[model samples]
Target: MGIEAGVAGAVLGRVGASERVVACTAAARAAGVRRGQRRRDAQRLCPELVVAERDLDAEGRAFETVAAAVAELTPRVEVVRPGVCAIPARGAARFHGGEEALRITVQDAVVEAGYDCGVGIADGLFAAELAARNGGGGLIVPEEGSAEFLARFPLSVLAGAVPDWDSLADLLVRLGVGTLGEFAALPADDVAGRFGAPGVLAHRLARGREPRDVAPRAAPPDLTVVRAFDPPAARSDEVVFAAKALADTLHEGLAAEGLTCVRLGVEVEFADGGVSERLWRHEGLLSSQAVAERVRWQLSGWRPAFTGDGTEAEEAVWGGVTALLLVPDQVVPDTGVQRALWGRDGDGARGELPERVARAADRVQAMLGHGSLTRPHLTGGRGPGERVLRVPVGDMPLETRPEGPWPGALPAPAPSVVPPEPRPVAVRAADGSPVTVSARCVPSAPPAVVVMPDGSGHRVISWTGPWPAHERWWDPESSRRLARFQVLTPQGAHLLTLEQGSWLLEASYE
Candidate 1:
């Protein structure tokens, strides 16, 4: 009756059942079995159906997987629903030989991916869907027979699978329309007057008339170069070397074509069954230096968790980076356009900012390693602590800033320093005496601090009041309160706190 149920149906189909056992057809389609269905009716239909609640997130992920599998055939794949996708065939058909071959290829891919799917090809989306539905398992509606094929289908077919089919049938019979042919013969004006626009449209469709056309898919730029490894690479350094060579090859090709690539795609395959991909882009033509920097950035950013004498790490490197492909998602003409390099002008210098930044990031990555350099990002929360955070540098937008400066809050422009490992520090009372902390301690009194390993005590210079912070007050299972203070010591400025009344150093500016 509405888009909600259609979306819910697609979500349910993707989630399916989670018990690892096959569900009976009746049980699987029971009310409440799908999203937005009533729970009581679903239980009544199949008591032993092993009903599993729908997982929208998992369903969405699975839908993407299916769409990616389809992308192997054609780059233009539109996911209409969790279980349904639409692919324009004019170009794909020509590339694969013919329409039949394209259909077969799609069918084979779906089957191989462990999905039971139906594919339909026609001049329009509606006709293609009808072809798919009528084909049962898999169907192809030929260009010439599209009109003839749709004519025999009843008006009910266009209504989709709704619950009130009997009521609709009764209404049709009351109107003296029993067959699709009879309904088609009705005048569009009369149908519109009686049942509205949807009815008139239904009449037109039954008579084999559709007024839509296939939309053309957008084509990417024309520069592309690929390199396949003879044997898989395993080490990060080896992968970097290979990527460097591949970048050179791509640069040479682009130079010869008199074009420049603004975007790059990197794909990696692992020996122990793993795959990773990354996309990179530049605002202008990628120079040789820029290309090399991109390759290094990609390699440095990847880290795999495994234990060995560095042999496994080496083997896990891009030695297995068997294939490397660079595609120009965007391109610009190399016209000899130039501006005077005088008064208030340096267009060339202004244009080189992207390349300079990229090069700088690459150098830092080479020296410090990937995941070390990062940019601040705003997290999706209103709290002071959650307002801003940091993520891998290149992975997120660079200009992302904090929501606003919070008064009486932690200092702005957080430290660029990051410790390899946390160094434990001993805290002391004003009398140079170690204080013991306990959960039952009153907030009015200060708690003791002790350094790890050796119990050395440091004197507190100045201290602020215990600002108590309580969170998750409504949830008893997660409720917690902490008393914090900015305590200055001879050694450094530190933020000391009693978390749930247990003494710990929250942070330090040394």
Candidate 2:
């Protein structure tokens, strides 16, 4: 999309909530940009790298073309995400000549639709995804060859296969289990014992098995939740917002039966009798948030057909959404989630709250909206104030400490108090002259006294250097130059900054 918008260079990246390179183009890969690399680091590596925030709505709308094209070859095209999808190979291949022929036909179909795609067939979805990403515009893994095909790949390939797998991959590497084959060679029981449930799942993937073990059982009750908008909803946001509660109800119903679905069906009915439907797949169980997100994408992707004369066709035009339905498919046993041993959440925060407390917070948020409750998150910056960001509860923060090194960052033992606003004060030398720092970062005099805005004075017992910093020097508009000093007053220690000849208290050490 950025390329189509005339963004310079083919080196492009999709930045995620963490402001990291969630996905990048081939040119970006060639330029040493990889997934999870911070935005700044990626720009540094490829100076012309064009980055855009990940827009699921736009991606969903764009992918509708590919999905429609693929549906011509196969009826059921399970959309894994905006860019990836899967189809049952056996039946589709037989109807389209052969597996190889089907792959070519599918790829050509999408290409003819003004999009390029890779088609790969394997025993399981995981292996098929890997095969699709293989070189040579993707390749088909031969029957029962998934294990062998995956063996040569390093454990790092499992990084994004599931949540928290990166850390597990690192641990496996340190244990001399460098490749899929090595990790697969370990006994499943031992892997479970040593690494617990997540290890078992990873081992299954390594051994070319489906990520989830299907324990076949009788189909549960219909776990469909529907919402009818009185008078119909003309705006997409109205329906999208309602999807959250609908999804929540669906999940609650499924939870009551100890069941979950691998695939979800989102069907929307328009007042004009028009219908829009899509299938979303998740190897693991989808949360309520996940379901609602897919709903948003589906709505964003929907479009009415046009007449031959470039005018909106009356039959194709949708008046408004009259009803919305969520149908759970491929239901399976809910094996439950494994809690982190250290009680840490996805963002590396020890965020596990008591069940009651968590419920209370969720209820409060539901009543007051997303931003009513928030928590502080640590981020990358030099000053204590800049290092922390407040994020809404249940929201993931976009910044992290690994973004890049802060060359002039403050030393360890951060201040205990960081004021919301700058507190201007006077730092005077013994002779009553205001203490000033030169452009060379040299202080005119060392000993000084502090005068607060309230007209209170405190004697400075000791002090640290007038460390100077030049930040964002390349950008003339946002650049800042300042000198900092840690002064120990008789009352307490304070972090003071000298910028443009004015002194402000930034933080205070307890």
Candidate 3:
């Protein structure tokens, strides 16, 4: 039952800024080596702990075999994480006769690939993860018993559910809610009022159901560029160089539009009616260097042989690659693209990095045959965020100023930080009850402690206005009545607004 047999006496740790254990053999954990502890601390805790750096590329490449194995067993396989995969239980169970049978089949397939494996089945992923961690070869919690089964577990068991879970778990335990059952018993409304969105989410999870609505993404516009290789490429280097040039040109166009491409498609069409195309995705903006690297990687993995002349590049290559196309599948605004304040000479003597970036963005716009990048600028509106307007850079010829004046708008000193999305927060009264604003713009009680969105307990040094703004009073769908307040903590002053019985951190004043 133990997974530690392979690395019985050896301990492996993933090293980052400072070595922190990500995975370690059972013997190491048993010896007190723990995750999140610094390398020095881990060594002190377990003298035999072995440290090594985590190579993400290596891990991902190795997991491809696991993906292939699972793919053969079922058409639907989703990588939950790099090392873990999830197969829809219903189809697999039906195909294998039953849930237990499906688990055995999967384990057998993975085992045949020379790896030890465990399987767990439960009502949801949360429970299933717990079931897997219990060290059973196959653990299944009947649907009817999922909630009851989870109730006995102490608050500490939810450590992996979210970041800062340990502290949050301990906080709940000290609040006299030591077990999942006790925590789940509290009303959802009360939990939300006392905590925030994360709290509400955990409450639902404890109840055995986690609702999720993943929206479908919109299609990306075509930003494809193609190059023809005449007389066919005689050498691999010739085709690879052409691919890099095409990729670089495509990316340069994107950069000009104050944008970056995340996924680029590289396609090759042979003269003999053969084609090869693959999309490459990156975690960050693909620079010219990055695009070139991808070109190299793709070339290294592909060997073009025109159907039957021969498998050798010289024989079956069929007049080499006739065409190389680079397509940007996904484009997003470059958030980090900023104007340089210093000179190009490294001392801000006199520089035009901003101009350079803008020209590149413009070239991208021309290449895409459309509008330039749109940036958000402020106009006039009741809400601080509502005032911001997204204006295409090419449209700067038009005036952006408001006609006259905003009568009820708050004076100068605009908020320094305004979150694109409001964050859930809790404002409490001096009596320890949750503070709220009424429909008539009245305080339920004097506000005291303010629980920031991060779950940190900050003491209210002093506070200001429940400035009420009622918008779209005509239509119920679009109408909203909010009372905005200014709260000051040691961190800084923040604007808190209450809408429909919920508090949100809208902006901050530095």
Candidate 4:
């Protein structure tokens, strides 16, 4: 977007879904702004940074330009992301004279189209990506030299190439495994035993091996599923709604044969006779809901490219979608799950129940809005309200509770009911006087009775606490100083807070 709009100087694009910086120009990177940093943190790093909300549609359109330029050389282009892509180079290399010649030709094409890119060739996709990023202009790794070429890089590189490797990478660093070569040297069996599947995959990549074999058995002919709209669906949601059912059917077909696809291809045919297609990667088999989300993202990114004028503004008047197709790529035999030996239905209601819940959530979210359904995640805080956060169902949990201990936090057996907002109530002493907390964190008197806002009273059977907390004292705008108490009454147990001479019912223990 910065390039298209000609807005130069420290530009960063943040994904709204995660509220994290997903892409940044070289200027921002040089200024110490990195991807995954919060928007505020990035802004702080580069005060003059120009932040832009990412538009999947624009990304889809811009990549079309890049893909078109590359497709001129080879038709088998596979996009890893909006800014990165791959192609089987052996055939293209031979056709274009050699690897070096092919690399030069691909780079020249993209540069001529007003974009800069690096071309790289290696034994596997992972090494090739590193080569493209690290190689100046372009570099071609000689056959059988991928492992040697990857040895010099740090273990941190694996975190970017593989999913869920960040924590593992950090652990490796702490254990003196600083480089890829060191990690690769570990016994494969030991790595598997310690880290399970993710570690094994990372170790394979570190050794210059692709996560899976290149020539996976082709999916059976009947695996591809298609749905055609009668009048050509005009709205994107209409297609998305259909995708959910299609994905369910596709998964069922795959399950019947005990198979799963590591990569999925979503194809959309416009009424104007233009076809938009993209490949999505999911190492852990894609769920039905996950497939529908990919379709939605593909549509969002494809809208501008589908427009006649190739502009976002003109997309509203573009042709409708006529048909949709789903093709499972990289078909492999599924390593089926082992059922629990003790109880048939183990913990968390495993099996069809979760899928049913996910489908129900999808429909509800479609009818309402994305934020209509949410799940609570625990995070670092001294109070029950501060410790819990509610986020939309499908969003990634960007924030996590720190492993460190909180000095003033409450003990175990957390509250069962945390209201959206605190409800004000009165806490009275035995003589009907209001209860208060002193400067030394001592209660004025034992809380004898709790009064509801409606004037009803519940006699306190037992009481504990004056757990005081001083939080964020440096930030006056958000600073908080409060005292909390737990009181058991005839009706139920309640978590109460006293601040500024008033008591508020914070939560209740069932």
User: Which has the greatest TM-score?
Assistant: 2
Q: Over the stretch 1-510, how does candidate 4's per-residue lDDT look in tens digits?
A: 354323323333422222566666655655766655666677788887787777655665566677767877887777676777788999998999999999999999998987777788999988997787555676888899998999998775664455445577778888889888888899999999998887898899989998876665654767999999989998887888899899989988998988887788888898998877777676546777767766766666455544456554432414788999999876778886544422123211122335566788889999999999887655667778888788887675776665335777887899999888899999999999999998899888999999976789999999999889887789999998899999999899999999889899999999
In model 3, residue pairs whose N, Cα or C atoms come closer than 3 Å (at least 3 residues apart or on different chains), thus clashing, are 253-364, 256-360, 256-361, 257-361, 342-348, 343-348
In TM-score terms, candidate 1 sits at: 0.34
Residue 447 lDDT, candidate 3, scale 0-100:
81
Candidate 3: residue 448 Cα off by (Å): 37
lDDT, residue 393, model 1: 51
Tens-digit lDDT track of model 3 for 26-97: 456557655455556667777765566665444443454565577678856544434556667887899899
Best by lDDT: 2
TM-scores for all predictions = 0.34, 0.69, 0.43, 0.65
Ranking by TM-score: 2, 4, 3, 1
Candidate 4 residue pairs that clash:
none
Relative to the true structure, candidate 4 reaches a TM of: 0.65
Candidate 1, position 375, lDDT: 56
Q: Write out the backbone clash pairs for model 2.
A: none
C-alpha RMSD in Å of predicted model 3 compared with the true structure:
19.2
Error of 1 at 83 (Å): 1.0
lDDT of 2 by residue, 63-145 (tens): 87787678777778789888888889999989989999998899899879887556788999888977876664679999999
Question: What is candidate 4's CA lDDT for residue 196?
Answer: 83
